[model samples]
Target: MRLSSKHVLVLSIASMAGHGAMAGQAESKGFIEDSHLDFMTRNLYWNHDYHSGHNNAQRTADRDRREWGQTFRLDFSSGFTQGLVGFGVDLSGYTVIKLDGGAGHSGQAGVLVPEGNSTAHEASSAGANLKVRVSETELKYGNNLRPYNPVFAPADARLTPATATGFWVVSNELKGLVAEAAHLTAAKDFNSTNLSDDFFAAYAGVASDTVDFLGASYSVTDQLSVSLYGAEYKDIWRQYYGNANYTYPLSDNQSLNFDANLYRTVDEGSSRAGDIDTTAYSLAAAYTWGAHTFKLTYQKIHGDQPFDYLGMGPGTFHDSIYLANSSQLVDFNGPNEKSWGAFYNLDMAAYGVPGLSFGARYIVGRDVDGSRMDADSPYNFYGSERSEDHWERDLEVKYVVQEGSAKGLSVRVRQATHRIGNGASDASADQVRLIVEYPWSIF
Candidate 1:
């Protein structure tokens, strides 16, 4: 059945109303009596230094952009009204205030703040969702959502999170399995209130109204899970994704883990994205002993176009494209690119500090096909010479209050560096971020 965006919501509400009328009214009181609300405050300090890798005067001049900001986040989720089909609502909003950003660095200093001449000092956004549940299936319509699927996993790396106007349905009736269908109409960028269809377009650069996806995930055992998904950007491209994760205990204090992801994309309909066809894969393995863990990863892209995913924000949380080299500073993804990574993680609890943790990771990518880039691409200077290489290193430490009056307070420090050769897609930069957050329930 075809339905306009407005009709989608109307139909959902109608269904909920019909279901509520049939179910016993007394049971529906739970919707209001079991509601939940929370408020959280977060403070962030970020700094970045950019330099030239090839003496490009333009890229060289932008340096040392710094910004500080604070955010208040509010969320409320209502329990569903008891019925054959239950109804509920979710409300969320965020407000931010810029603390510092003394103009100089291209306003990109605060990647999460909408930039004015320097950077916006304040911004806020709010969203509400109406949801209907029948058995284990749920349908929702709204802006703020967290799907965690391969196609549209919105970014939360910034102060403001990505949001989209859309409708979705999910089912979890089957044990250890979830199935989903989503349609997104428009998206708001991470830092701005403005909605745009072209926000995440890069290849063909054409923006479309609706993006649709269907996916299913299954947890076969306590230590194994798998997912498969397919998506289409109307008039652009169609993509399929697959993922698997597994963990096994090796000994009393040791364990091993494995993860793999694969994606296939092809042009759809009129091929607005210009005959898109691409294949990408990522694989990782990890071993943990006591409070220490080590990991290795490999990633590769096979196609004319680079492996890319949808994101209204600047970037997704971790390896949005399922690539090992998607570091804090750069996603080492380019046409025909291949990358490898190594990482280590440590928990201070082993040494008596229960709420502290540290981590370090390094990724290197090569075989970038700069030659294949057309006018739509970034690096036109180099062609298939494929000599472009880039590497990134990231170090992070974090501490959280485990107990006491200040419990739930967390402090994190992150530093990273991206060094690139001549054919790289992005610039070389050094970044440092300090974030502190104290979350206490306001409900």
Candidate 2:
């Protein structure tokens, strides 16, 4: 007697097709195809020194050890049908092998753990996602690892987020306009495959089963766009976001870009037992000339406590780039904490290599107060007992084959160093990562 959401969607599409035919609507149908097979390997080495000692560190609890691992991922995408409305799907998975690690070393954060025995079974997991398309829209149900915005996901590092089982809808019904909505209830961490409801408690206390979000985007012109979004966790919290981006051609060979974002959040119901009210903002500007691109960003958070939100896991890193590194936690875009970053990127194509690039970035955060730590333990929250200032510098280089048998082969390396002052936590460390990928079209 009950119908699944996918089945409902299919029936709706069929009904729409019938109606369109009766109305003499335009009719066209075709099946398009696309796919990517990738093999990615990652290696990380961390050297960390606790600010308040290991027991008092924000991220580490019992001791400090250098850890490393190798991770592999394969992702694929498919195109949908062509007509008044269409449909499609996506699939992806990952595997992690110890390579070199021990009991005290394994499961530090995003790394996978071997199953019953440390030999091999414990370190591998795989999953897939299914999506349906209707016209310029899509509806996805199943496992998904990609999440947008700085306040919603923890993606400042090379590792990915845990997969989430939910339903997401995106639509582009009108030119230059986009809309999105989602209702997710279960999740699995980056290194996990078995779905769990644990995050819901940390996110909204004990009574909620769904996380709902709605958002829209519009492009005002060729180089200007704006967005507004809202998210609500029943009996938990409600948050809103607004952002704008613009790009101007200063000349034939130079351009200027600007971005601004603002967020406001507050508690919602009986589950909103914590003291939390937050507001944050960020502004950024960039200049591009010839082969060089330079950028600068400034951010601030205003709240009694640091800005806090959902995250992938304990070892996840947070940053200000709302796209790749969503800024989250206490003092995030809050009062008492301020941040700034500088970055530069180069396109080798301008010099001759069409598929090579390099980039460097530096970021600093100051005036972070951790006087009020959360009751769930340090790792579960953002604040510590000490006020601290931190800085991070990163460098990366990447290349992709332009043609031939390995045309889609890609290789990249990244290195980063973080330092903390004022004895804040154990997040300060030096890290290096290596990744190689090859995508083969199987259409």
Candidate 3:
């Protein structure tokens, strides 16, 4: 049986209300007794080397962009008060200090906010949210949200993660089901200290007044789950997403998994992005034996326009695209693009070296034809290109301290190389990122 978006939303709300009524209010301890405070520090070194000819013409002096910075994030969550309807608050603050990267190397890398020809030495911001709860349903309103849903997820790939100013509802009263709704008005970019930054489309660079979305996920069985979501970007477009995931155990130390994600987007209202109508999807399969796993993925776009999502600022790319083919350096989401990838992962726990891991992936895309795009659309710049292609290769290694005073300390390194055909507009580059993080818990 097929269910429309409206039907799914209604059903989810009805189920949530019914279950919440039956469950009654949850018993809460004193707010101070259940409160928590956490502090984390992240040190990052980012480097991007553009191939000689692929460098941006506007930044002719910057063939290689690099930045080194350290970020301190503090989060506090207060427990609900004892009552039929409980109340709580969440607070978050972030501060970043630049350790390296001057005018010649800081160019648009998004690791730090640029000031004149140089970069900011320090930046900081703070936010708070108020929350209310009854049974298993909760609502939050404020600027400290970092949602991870497919429709409007924020990115944390740089020194700091993006945050949104909005209201959101979550209900988990029903068993094995999660339902959510959100309305976002603005966002704070990772590199900016502004608490209320405008939201823009990644590819079109057009601002959006607001974003609203509804979603639900249900676990059908022990090994199967599915999710559905719908969203509207004010007057720009409407988007719908669906996902299915399954895992089967083949033996005591072996398993197989499959995941699929699909999206349908169409222009709406004013169509500010200009006549966008696209269908994009990805399918992935993986097999694991002992501590080793291998995966393969295929992704495709069936429209004249490329698949796009929310962007935080001028250069801060959001992680709203949940496709399997989106990798470290490229999204592989050109107009009418088809891509395939292979990935491998290794864990050292089986070899008595816990807290160490390695991973690698390679993806290639082809048949990127954008010549048929609308003449006035934001993507018209790509209309001169046809039958383009690109490929990327990535490698990563990470280690975490398992036991001792620095038990939670972690260090990770990632490297990627991307090359695009001449017909494509994207620049070819080699990128490397080194990250070190440690966390502390304070009452």
Candidate 4:
């Protein structure tokens, strides 16, 4: 059903009227409501270079660029109705106003697209989303950013793309069970005002014209959970995924967690590979003690090509970078490649500094060969290289104001340095990010 602006208003009024009538009769007349608002600003500095055999020969000497900019974001979510079949709405929106930098500094990076060539700066449309919900489920509509394993709409970068036009149903109707399904069209790549012209375009060896997916998750026990998912992109490929995670207590103050993810994909009708099949997998473990967490992950790609995703992946977290220490880069983990990551986090809040924390991680890639770059596919992060290796280190510190005028205000500082081994094109560089965020609640 198409709902014009007028119809939406009328329906909202009618819903309120019905609730009033019930209230007068002593029936549950009042619905609890809560309002949430969050705002954040970030200052970022980036420097990158493309070298021979890196990113497919996009070398820094030939196309080196550096960028610095600031980004602002606001988010809001509403509460539901009071009754058994409650109704509610949620909103996620943000705008990017370029502070300084342009295409000349073009890694294009994550936020704010250049207006002309790679030198002009332009403001991007504010990404926004609206969602309606029932008892324990939600029907999300409009452009929103989603960050999760698999199909993530990145929002972690200085500026990230916002996916447009999609509907999803998310439910937790049964104990320990969760399910979701969606159809998507149109995407606003981070920092650009225009949606991708290829939003639903299909390619023989590249993107699918449209993307459809369904997923379900179940918790078998407090310490274990499993998930299954399937997806199809017309004329491209069909993909399936399975994931499992379990937690085990090792001692009174420590625990061990294990996680595994696997994917199986096959080219379908009109796909570039006709009937080719591919697989990718990852395993990770973490041990946690009071105030400290140590983690390790091993990833592998076992096909003749890189994994394909809608636009790009790994933007689902506050700190995701392709092939980086923490970001989910599928490239380094692509066909015939193996990678490892080791990281640690410390929550100073547990010791004394409430809302203070620090963390660091190192990631290494090996046995990566890009000689098989998917012809004409820009999706490949590695250029035409026979073998590659690289490592990155990241450090971050954060603090949140606990009390006083600035109570709830949060600040974070992050730094990263990367050095590539032979056959990689990415530049050796350093990055620094500064961010401040706050939230307000209304009831």
- Candidate 4 residues lying further than 4 Å off, grouped into runs, are 1-32, 35-38, 49-53, 56-64, 80-93, 102-107, 113-130, 145-147, 195-206, 272-276, 312-331, 370-386, 424-429, 441-443
State the weakest 10-residue window (summed lDDT) of model 1.
17-26
Residue runs of model 1 more than 4 Å from their true location after superposition? 1-29, 53-63, 115-119, 195-199, 202-206, 313-319, 373-385
Model with the higher TM-score, candidate 2 or 3: 3
* Cα lDDT over the full model 4: 0.59
Q: Write the per-residue lDDT of candidate 1 for residues 1-443, one digit (tens) a residue.
A: 87543454445444433432233333556787878898788888888888645324434555666778888889899988885767899998888888777465555554555533253678777888898877666788887666667876766666766677788877665678777777788877666666553335443345667777777899999999999988777777788999999999999999999999888988776765565578999899999999999999999888767776675533323224655556788766677889999999999999999999999999998888856556554334335556788889999999999999899999999999989876535678899999898888765
Candidate 3 lDDT tens digits, 66-132: 8888999999999888777788999998888888874566455677653222445787889999988
- Compose the digit string of candidate 2's lDDT tens values, residues 1-443: 87543454455344433321211112223334334455554554433333342323434652343345566666666555555545556777666655544456433434444321234433555656676665555677776645564334534243434665677666665678776666677656554556653344232234345566767789999999999887766565677889999999999889999999887767666544365576777788999998899999888777655444564333333332353222222223323568888889999999999999999988778776545535652222334544567777888899999999888788787777666665444355555566665556554
TM-scores of all predicted structures: 0.87, 0.77, 0.94, 0.77
**Would you list the C-alpha lDDT of every candidate in the order shown?**
0.74, 0.59, 0.84, 0.59
TM-score of 2: 0.77
TM-score of 4: 0.77
Worst 10 residues of 3 by lDDT: 52-61
Q: Alpha carbon lDDT of residue 109, candidate 4? A: 50
**If candidate 4 were superposed on the true structure by all CA atoms, what would the RMSD be?**
7.1
True-structure Cα RMSD, model 1:
4.3
Report the poorest 10 consecutive residues by lDDT, candidate 4. 313-322
Candidate 3 — which pairs collide? none
The lDDT, on a scale of 0 to 1, for candidate 1 is 0.74
